[model samples]
Target: MKYSIISILLSLITLFFSIKINLETLIDYLSTDGKSQAFHGLIELKYLYKYYFLILSFLSSLFLVFAFKINELKPFKHSAAFILILGIVSVFTAFWKWFI
Candidate 1:
């Protein structure tokens, strides 16, 4: 249950950062659409998600550790359990996008 809450918080934080990065990327892309520069804006965008990958992977690993040691979320618990699954899915989905 705690892991689920933590996961949701982390995921939300990541999402907020993701939106900011995306906006920056969009601006960069538009600003450089016609003019040629020494550094390509798209290149910057390409590597921007690396930090998120590291963050989410580290978080997921930490969740696994604590889940096994302390959480032990049961599948049938319903309320918190459902929240936990939702949190996990959101984290994994964001992580997956950053992954590839």
Candidate 2:
């Protein structure tokens, strides 16, 4: 039960990192000219956020596995699995932006 709760929480956190871009970053990125160093920096930061998504996805996957094996986690098993799958898909579909 506790494992499931933690798994669900971590899965959500991973999903959050996958999609949590602020308007300020976009505004800054759009406002800067292509030749500006700030433009490159902002782009780099956005890619860095994706790196976090990968790391968290890995951790969340582990928790989901543990939770899935436990009988006590029956109530939350589906939700935990679903959210974790969503987080992973966020990474795979980054180029396509299929589901942010």
Candidate 3:
């Protein structure tokens, strides 16, 4: 149960960072000119960081789900479900950016 709570917390952290990086990327993309100068260091970092966070979020969410299932604690089940949904949404958002 403790591990599951920790995993959910980590997932939330990852989600936060992922969203932050995404917003920064969008702002940079919209503000930049047609020049390739925008693809420099920080932009590359943001791109890579977002994916890292997304991956972290997925792993943590998985851990939480597994732990919660093993414990079968009704109290935390709702929270676990919410985090799982959040993780799925984050995964979709991350992939959407890559594909589109």
Cα distance off (Å), candidate 3, residue 20? 0.6
For all candidates in order, the CA lDDT equals 0.51, 0.66, 0.64
Residue-level error in angstroms, candidate 2, position 50? 1.6
lDDT score for residue 31 of model 3: 65
* TM-score for candidate 3, residues paired by index: 0.60
Q: CA lDDT of 47 in candidate 3?
A: 70
- Model 1 residue runs over 4 Å out of place are 37-53, 68-100
The residue-by-residue lDDT of candidate 2 on 43-91, one tens digit each, is: 6455555656677667777777787666654668788888888878765
Tens-digit per-residue lDDT, 1-100, candidate 1: 6765565455556555555555555455556645643465445646455365447535844664565567466542233334444444543343322432
Q: Which pairs clash inside model 3?
A: none
How many backbone clashes does every candidate have? 0, 0, 0
Error of 1 at 17 (Å): 0.9
Winning candidate number (lDDT) = 2
- Taking all chains together, the TM-score of candidate 2 against the true structure is 0.64
So what's the TM-score on candidate 1? 0.49
Candidate 1: Cα lDDT at 1: 65
Name the lDDT value of residue 17 in candidate 3. 67
Where does candidate 2 stray beyond 4 Å?
22-46, 95-100
Q: TM-score for all predictions?
A: 0.49, 0.64, 0.60
lDDT of 1 at 39: 62
